[model samples]
Target: MIAKPLAKIRCLKSAQCLDETTEDQIDFEVDFVFPLTEFDLQFVGCEVINFTRKIIERSQPTPKQLIGLAHALHALECLPAITPGISVEYGLQLRKGDDEFAEFKYWSVSINEESFEVTSGGSVYDSSVGSDSYSGFKLYVEAGSYGYRECSDDSYGWIESTVEVLNLGGVLEVSDDSGRGCIKGTDE
Candidate 1:
């Protein structure tokens, strides 16, 4: 079965239009209400907070308890962005032990590369990931366009510097996006 996020997160996408009433930047706010499976994220905002916050709900603590993410969090590691002339669309998928992949909000976040300045939000992380143990999760990324090992000058691509945001346990590698975007497994 495909794993699903426990909750829904809304985030600010891009507002690249002038308002008809006033010549001010129109605040275009909308909810990407589509269901997110194990780990695909579309805009990358509150969900990242939801994930990083690690606001776990335990049966003992009034049926819902918030833990970890006690202190201020470090910069997010899973924020995937569209690079100019880089990739038209970018996505991250969580891999299961079954070798089947679970997707976050959506499979691919269509990037508006042409827009002068398009900004979106990405949840840092959530659930019990980044641990030596199961952390209850893993991720998947195919080769060809999605291979991260392809990092270097002639062969290298842009890499996201990452830091584990959980208060308690974290993985061996800090950067979630192995090279381009995403934390593969507990070891990664």
Candidate 2:
């Protein structure tokens, strides 16, 4: 039998804009809502915070003059624990000379009368040329444990095996299946 759809799912957007003529700078802000249902907010929130910090640290150098900006980007207080049927919002800001960008990570959770499924996916962007980028997904709660599958593009990247979890008593298993490919093109 097919599972029933969620009772309610909604997303809202919030934005702010600022233009400073004296400093010749402009700021634009927008809200990113993560639609999560039937998942632990604390578990996901911890991972999100850690992931955001890693991305920021790897993408840019610590700005001595912009300590506040750095702190704001890694603020964990912005995210609050959420209950089912509610969406959590995060603010994204863009300003001049900041080429740094955080790719939006997507997640979905489904719960039927008996079993549940959770999946999350996102791609990492490397600003520098010749660097590798990774895209992958993770599945939680297989036999009470978690498993994941990932793919990488570009040279010097390692291939990974696929992991699958069956709903029968949360048994976890891994397959030897693996593959890798690199896109060949000129940098325009």
Candidate 3:
């Protein structure tokens, strides 16, 4: 049987990125680490802190910022079997925000045998109302040395390519559908 939803977090207004062609685009890379300590699943009642780094890019005429939202369930999926009685699952989404600048909002739910509750954007979810729910965070990235690039020989135009990993630590070299190259993360 599917385990009951225990704790979840979600980002509603998360990230944004604007692309301008006039600036000098350089190739660069960055690594985002989600250590086990951040999940804090060792304790049943402790609050898990959800967070993401921000990225900004400057160019003539227009500037862009990248942002996104994520959710997780059965958190145990990413952890080693050393810990017992802990589980989580998660998902994420990235899109444009409602405002001109990037904005972010989040929700969380914690469960114990006695009750099931949800907290989102400083408001508590009404248990009486039947609705779908989930959990996660947000991330933003802007052009650095490794920003968006046009595919050398394709009609696909521009592609933003990068590698992202959760839990395991390693070096990943990747390319976009348009064949633009990107190297992300680091070995640890």
Indicate which candidate wins on lDDT: 2
Q: What's the C-alpha lDDT at position 121 in model 1? A: 23
lDDT of 3 by residue, 111-160 (tens): 21112222322112344543334423222111122322111222111111
Largest TM-score belongs to which candidate? 2
Candidate 1 local lDDT, residue 155: 9
Per-residue lDDT tens digits of candidate 1, residues 54-119? 323111212111111211111121122222121222222222332232222112222222211111
Better of 2 and 3 by TM-score: 2
Give RMSD (Å) of candidate 3 vs. truth.
22.0
> Which should have the higher lDDT, number 2 or number 3?
2
Tens-digit lDDT string for candidate 2 (100-134)? 54343333332221122334444444466433333
- Over the full model, what C-alpha lDDT does candidate 3 score relative to the true structure? 0.19
In model 1, state the lDDT of residue 151. 12
TM-scores, one per candidate? 0.19, 0.22, 0.15
- After superposition, the stretches of candidate 3 with alpha carbons farther than 4 Å from their true spots are 1-84, 89-95, 98-100, 112-117, 122-188
Better of 1 and 3 by lDDT: 1
Per-structure clash totals for the candidates:
21, 1, 32
